[model samples]
Target: MYKPRINNKFHKHQIMMEDPCLAEFIPETRLFTNNNLIDLLNKYKKVIVKPSRGSLGKGIVVITELGTEEYELLQLNKQKHINGLENVYKYLKKLENFNIPNIVQYYIPLAKVYDRPMDLRYIAQRTEQDWTITGKYARVAKVGYALTNFEHGSSILTVEDALKSSTIKNFNIKELNEKLNMVTLSITTCLSRYFPNHKIWGCDLCVDEKGSIWIIEVNSSPQIKGFLELESLLPMYQSIVGYKTLNKKKGRRSR
Candidate 1:
């Protein structure tokens, strides 16, 4: 029986790891061993441990400062923890023993919309000679969830709505768009230098209290599900690939 091979989800991360600047966009990650976990908690006093290749917001935990002595631990899709360090470590160790490949990321206090965390997902594509913004959507974390992934029952809204909401005070929609576009272009341009042929990309970014944008993650194969008028997107993708093929043929003939 022939079996289908699994695609490595970390392939994109490996590529990003090759470039120092790109790697900085990735979260601070480490294997979940006892020593590593202890060190993480001690250094940051608050950290998040998640699956390395996880998606959809499963198996995530948020650690926050309660006081000098106490800590709060909240599990993704679960109740909050207001307990001591001993209990928290026990709970996390149990999760670690479950054979899940986990990493601890420095928790970024994201800007909020409606008392909920908000993040930007920018869809980007490369044309024959230029990289362009295809679309951008804001992912808002559902009540009581740590991450703003759709699988965790989060809601999706346009970037426009997020900026206009009262929760996002001091928000400027036009300026946000400009900043997001600039970051997307910068990331795509840097990646293109290494993989000149790769064209499509999706970037996850977060804005902190000071309105500075920080890249959270990068996705190579972006899901176009729920995008409006995807029929319009098909032609753009066709033209990009079509032009590349035509150029390759012309080069061969000239040679």
Candidate 2:
């Protein structure tokens, strides 16, 4: 039997947009083209160009407007300055993955913890009837970086710990926590409609400087070692282990 999982980022975005309730969590994403990149940049001033099928934060580019007719491109934690939008487009197009499908999306000004960007991973597993949030944890990027991958010098923390020190100012922690749960649950529920046999989902999400949550992407197979390594996440981590044990009895598997 085939795995009931989707890896194409563009397709996942299309389905997430279908739900009216998810409109706030979905960003403006378009296929990567010089024209599309120009248009997105014109509107958002900052955008991300990433491989549609890539993961682990590899081959992702963050483009920011530096000044009039000037742009900065950041990749793998290093950045360069380009003189004009045309030049920026040309540089990106010369990359090896340029000819293949990629996506250009609005660059979220992520809520920061001590000037380092932070985002979360929420794991939801299907029970007999509905999806349950099994586990979650936040990733804080190393100072002066864009992507938040644990393997790329990021540090993991409980969501509360990271946000408490955020520059977002005084806010209700409980309410903000609920929003994260709701967004991930809604995303998993929406994705299951397309891949019904899929029993688990790992959704990546981030909060903007405005405190609004954005669903980054859904993973069919998320890395588990991050959860296992964190002492503060022991409870949620055990929940995932329990879910795995239960799934084994039912012959459910993942890829």
Q: What TM-score does model 2 achieve against the real structure?
A: 0.92
lDDT of each: 0.67, 0.86
Error of 1 at 2 (Å): 30
Q: Please name the candidate that would achieve the greatest TM-score relative to the true structure.
A: 2
Tens-place lDDT digits, model 2, residues 1-255: 233339888888888887987877888999898899999999999999998887888779999998899999999779899998989988988888776788999988889887898998989998776899988888999977898988888888888888887766567889999988988888887887888877788899988777788888888888877886687788888888888788877774553
lDDT of 1 by residue, 131-180 (tens): 87767777788997768876666677777776666254465768877877
Steric overlap count per candidate? 0, 0
Candidate 2 wrong stretches, greater than 4 Å: 1-5, 252-255
Query: What is the alpha-carbon lDDT of model 2 when measured against the actual structure?
Result: 0.86
Model 2 residue 230 CA deviation (Å) reads 1.8
Query: TM-score per candidate, in order?
Result: 0.72, 0.92
